[model samples]
Target: MVQVMRALRVSRFGGPEVIKMRQIECPVPQVGEVLVRVRAAALNPADWKLSAGLFQSPMITLPFTPGFDVAGVVEEIGPNVTGFQRGQAVIGWTRRGSFAEYTVVPAGVLAVAPANASFGEAATIPTGASTAWQGLFDNGNLQAGQRVLVQGAAGGVGQFAVRLAKWKDAYVIGTASTSNVELVRALGADEVIDYTATRIEDAVHDVDLVFDTVGDATLASSVQAVKRGGTLVTIAGMPSEEKVQEHGINVKSFGVVVTSDLLQNFSQMVDDGALRLLVGATFHLEDASRAYELCQGGHGRGRIVFTVSK
Candidate 1:
């Protein structure tokens, strides 16, 4: 008999209230895919943005699951798949259907979960960490001994930027609210500026690289923080090319591209104790809507996860 599993899905674009938990037939793995018995899933701002009808594309049709990051045990492998076995712990981004009991993920997108982290913690890595990794190392060209400033350092991607910048041996300065100042500092920031108390323009200057997770005025201010000929990388939005050239600063905008190589590097960082997952809260699979609500509430200090089992 075909099996059915619980999934959180939405048939229309709207708020968290639109999501519904329902039983759906389990998906089968295809070539180069693996079916994961999802133990946990992480929430991202993209989840809500997509749900609210932003970035609509042909790939994302209506009545879909919103989660992207998942950590789980392998339940089955598709034809020609290698390097993974049933019952292995793994994590990756599935384009859709991750907020379910089982998700079919491309084998190349997954990596073994870190030995030190629980499924909930591991689930938080794929999206936030990979975004930070791409923004800092791949695009920003952050180098050791260079000064880097991270705006919004308390959020999911921001905190990972803090840790990864420090791991790269860059002198890191981060801006956060007063409540998260110490949290950002503990994540290896050499300096923490409370944006609530001080203006970023007044407090930080002469940075070699500026990573802006918060856009708008914050992104605009970042151009001024970097020294002449320095780089400003924004994950939220691209700054104007004309504006960048006027200041003689190099500017780039990035949308994260997750690959096996990136996931492997992140797993290695976790194994080496250089990276850590900060889970702000966890909800059961049935409460997936509430999890998304908490994430969208904009007050969460870190990643929110949904436990699929146990």
Candidate 2:
């Protein structure tokens, strides 16, 4: 008999209403890939945006699943795949889509899930945490003793940015709404500015790195906070090229590159308590419509996760 699975499908592109639950075939792992029995899947801005038809990608088609991150147990391995066994817990960026009871992930991107984190917490890493990790270390080249600013410090990626920067011994400043100011500080930000009342550029200056998880207006103003020679790395919108050239500073907006090394580092940090994760809300697979709605609503405090199993 053929096997089937439950998945959140986007049959049409428009709004959160486009997403619905559907019964689908359980994907089989191909060579260099593994089929994961998903425990949880986390939402990213791109996920909902794709549902709303915001991001352009030739690969996106109707009746597709909408997720990038997954934490699950390995159910099967494919040809030429090694180092992973059936039933091993793992977390990864599937890219193909993960909002399902089963999803196939490339073996190269998979990492052993952090033992200390629940599936929900581990789910936050693939996209959100990795984005923060790469922005600071890969793009910004932030070093110990340097001063760094985290834009939207109470956000999913921002919390990871603050914790990771501090673990590297950098002096970390964070911008947040008043409601989350204390949360950002507790995450180890050396300074937390309530962005609602104070503009980030005015409160601090001459930082070595500005790690922007918030873009647009906040990112535009954040440029001045960087020392003339410092770097501005944004995961959100990009600043104009002309404006960057005039500032005499380095600027980069990078897509997170997920490798076993990067994933392991994030897992190790979580295990060591140098980093932590939070799931602002969790919905079962059947409730994905509501999950998509909340994620699209914006200004959420934690990662939105769908607990697919257990």
Candidate 3:
């Protein structure tokens, strides 16, 4: 008899109501992949957006699982894989199959979990922190002592951006609602702008980099804050090439790149107390619908997670 695992599946694109749980075969690891018995999984913007068909990329197939971040114990490894042992705790980005009891991912994306953090907290690292690392360092090319502004700094991705920038020794400024101003500041932001009370342009200007996590009007406003030769990078929306050329500023919008090295570095950072993991709320595997609902609201405090086995 084949073993079965529970997973959240989206058969059709719609609202939070569309997510449903189904019991399917427990996946066997293929060559160069590992089978992780998921202990916890965290939510990202893509969770609800994909569920709503808003970010329907070619990579997605119908009736697929929604989660991208997972923290769990390695249950088994496939042929041609080495260095990881069974029962070791790990966290990494999944290929869209993490909202389940068991999932398989390429070994290249797996990294040892931080010894100091819980499964729920570890689950938050893969997508959010990797994006932050790529956005600030790779794409934005933020340098130490340079001024960097993180737009919407209180959200999931924004929080990590602020912390990572601070880690790199950048002078960090962030924008958040009044409720999250102090929180952003406490996360090592040297300056926190209450976006509710002030326009970004009015409060700050001539920054070396603007890390915009909020798009649309906010992203448009952030360009004014960047120095003439500075860089503006956003994960939320694509800036027009014309706008970037007209201002003569480097602009980048990109998806997260998950690598074993990146995940290992993040784990070390967490263990060394250089980075903090914030879990705003958690739900049982059965209550995933409720979890998705809260995330869809776009105001949940930090990472929203699902406790799958623990």
Error of 3 at 11 (Å): 1.1
**Mind giving the per-residue lDDT tens digits that candidate 3 earns over 1-310?**
1299899999999998899999988889999999998999998888899889997578878989878899999999999999899999999787748999998878999999999999999999998899888999999998999999999888888889999999999999999889888889888899999888998889888999999988988877788899999989988887667877777788888888899899999999999999999887889878877888889888767789898985
Locate the minimum summed-lDDT window of 10 residues in model 2: 293-302
Q: Candidate 1 — what's its lDDT?
A: 0.88
User: Please, what are the lDDT tens digits per residue for candidate 1 over residues 18-84?
Assistant: 8889888889999999999899999888998888888778988988877899999999999989999
lDDT per residue, candidate 2, 1-310, as tens digits?
A: 2299888888888887778888988887889999998999998888888888888778877878889899999998999998999889999888778999889999999999999999999999988788888899989999999999999887778888898899999999999888888888888899999988997767989889999888989877778888888899998898877777777789998777778778888899889987888887888878777877887776777688889887
Candidate 3: worst 10 consecutive residues by lDDT?
Answer: 238-247
Off by over 4 Å in 3: 240-246
Q: How many residue pairs clash in each candidate?
A: 0, 0, 0
What TM-score does candidate 3 reach? Answer: 0.96
Using lDDT as the measure, which candidate wins?
Answer: 3
lDDT (Cα atoms) of all candidates against the true structure = 0.88, 0.87, 0.89
Q: What is the lDDT of residue 53 in candidate 1?
A: 88
Instruction: Return the candidate ranking by lDDT, descending.
Output: 3, 1, 2
